[model samples]
Target: MSRQLAVMMVLLAASGLAQAVTKCQNGSETLYTSASCPAGYRNVTGSMRSHVMTVPGVAKNQEADRAMSALRMQAAAQNQADEEMDLRAQNAFWNQCLVIDYRVRATERAMQTTEYWSYADRYREHADALRALQYGMGCLG
Candidate 1:
């Protein structure tokens, strides 16, 4: 029992001799040492100790990453919406061009089949106007 007590005492004394570490920072550089910080370096050992020991600047970096991700997602959504709107506008323009082309074809047919030269001339003028509108609207291109 006496030997056991001596061993326990030695163990306790050894545990109590555990070295303390100090963290120091100078500008953007960091260092750890068993002694106090050197000149031009600030002691940051107290701030470095916490329940979880979260590193400094990590939390801020994570927040910035989340903000950047949100902005990228918003920009992608806006681009998709703009592309969809442009497609819809193009579809509408093509539909209108098809209707105008049909009208011009019907007028040409009428001009060819009519016996009255005056009616034929009117039909020709109407077809020419429709063609002009189609070209002006970029449908011919």
Candidate 2:
């Protein structure tokens, strides 16, 4: 009976020791079942970690930002082109009006020197044409 009791105590002690085992590995894949690694070995199981996983919305938000920037660039280029074209058209019309005014003054001078009233009539016609064009184009109120 004493021998059986001793065997039972040994089995219980072995089982308790087995339960206390904690698996630990080092950088070289060496495993230890103790509280600390021996000399020349470091504990790798506690400090090793993985990076955080990416959320699904982050990629979508980045794509949306890129698209908005591209659209803004396109709109800015278009607006610049429109302003340039508007300036060119305004300069052309201004030059045309200057030429018409010059013609009117020349015809008036000719009428004053030659005693030909027809030149005065031509001046009036040119002035009227300029005024009509300016009004039609919304340049004159």
Q: What does each candidate score in C-alpha RMSD?
A: 12.9, 18.4
Per-residue lDDT of model 1, residues 25-104, tens digit only: 99988776557799999998777633212223444667898999999999999999999999999999999999999999
Number of colliding residue pairs in each model: 0, 0
lDDT of 2 by residue, 53-91 (tens): 112333466689899999999999999999999999999
Model 1 weakest 10-residue run by lDDT: 49-58
Model 2 clash count equals 0
lDDT scores for all predictions? 0.78, 0.59
The segments of candidate 2 whose C-alpha lies over 4 angstroms from its true place after superposition are 1-55, 117-141
TM-score per candidate, in order?
A: 0.61, 0.48
Using lDDT as the measure, the top candidate is: 1
